[model samples]
Target: MRTVLHGRPLAARPRRQLRDHGDVHQDRLAATFADRCEPYRGYGAGAFTILRKIRQGTPWKEAAGSAFNGQGSCGNGAAMRIAPLGAYFADDPKTVTTQAIRASEVTHQHPEGVMGGLAVAHAAAVAAKARLTGTPPPDLLGSVLDHLEDSFVRKGIEKARRIQTAEEAAYVLGNGSRVTAQDTVPFTLWVAARHLGDYRAAITTCVQAGGDVDTTAAIVGGIIATPPREWRDEREPLPDWVRR
Candidate 1:
């Protein structure tokens, strides 16, 4: 239980500076985290910078949009640290998507960003539900996809359903190379689906697929690891680093 929640921040921190700080007033949250945690020390660049702008009194919509000179960010940041929220609301797919949107809008104001978070949350909710019901692992990806409204995300998940291996998933659905929500979430859900019954395999799959490993692993790991310990006995024990 504790181990599961702990995994989310550990997996998320190494890839990016932010820890999905929720919807805090950017500067206050930034200062608090930056001062308290060693990991938040020097890593803020993309989303963090935008967050800073918001803290300095810029509106969230404008601050986020100005990140790439008004292009806004579609980064996987929202998706990377959102699994816990999904698990927390495991019984409600509608609430998962709705809340995911609110969560992402705090920093990730782009449609793609919000979509990515929603997709991951919806998947986690489905995964959590499956765990609760003892459902088998077939069509898990389809279940996750059913809750999404984004066309590109839907198409990507559709592609993921046909893919058999993580390597193939990475190649076709993307492995987070672009860092956009579209480039990250699809493949993560695929990996999560393929390795839902085994936590270690899910993490390994993300590492092997290779782009933005930490974030992908965080998203996949968080969702796949949500099942109770009894349901996941086949999963390898936590790695040394994770346990420590």
Candidate 2:
């Protein structure tokens, strides 16, 4: 919401949003994410560091590049929030890919982390196009994989293609247990692919898989589902800034 309202380039919006509102925990839902949980009160560790630097007026590239002893972070943090960006560029796959990388670079400079965001963004873009056509993507994961370069994240997604069940996917591909993009994006994409038309089912599968449930559910939900009204009613209203 801040991104759209700021009227800035997509690549520039995340840094400003983080600087101004990164630590606000507005969700009223019952979740155990540390950032959203009491006492922690901010983004995950990787994002927190980047946000701190951004708040200090550090450039996005420098802030991101400085993390984890200069290797940057490969955490799923970048991927978790990128589905909307993919949908925004739904008609342009190339832009979706490029912008996703730029967006991730604000807080995740590691190639795996950037690739995770790329994959999820592309998945959301494909799903958005599918929604417009009123036909589900015949090979959603494959479509996302086509846009990705070689990486463990890509390999994990390939492994996702061979899995038949969510439980099996969570077991083999991991259920965001490691909090890395390599561990999380593949399984979330698998769920999104299998339950693209069923928002409730997609979220249920994420919760049942259990590890990093909030992030996994957020990624899948951003791709293929909007929460039902009943579910929405249980959560806090969107902030005024988001509404604007």
Model 1, 136-214: lDDT tens digits are 6568777877877756767898898888777788999999878778888899989888888888778778888888777
Q: Pick the candidate with the highest TM-score.
A: 2
Write candidate 2's Cα lDDT for 1-244 as tens digits: 1112111122223323434543212121001121222223335677666666665666666777898899999987668777767877788898787767866766688999999999999999999999999988999999999999999999999999999998899999999879899999999999999999888899899999999887788788878846777776666554343444
Identify the candidate with maximal lDDT. Answer: 2
Which residue pairs show backbone clashes in model 1?
none
Give model 1's TM-score versus the native structure.
Answer: 0.75
Please estimate how well model 2 matches the true structure, expressed as its whole-model Cα lDDT.
0.75
TM for candidate 2 is: 0.83
**Model 1 Cα displacement at 26 (Å)?**
11
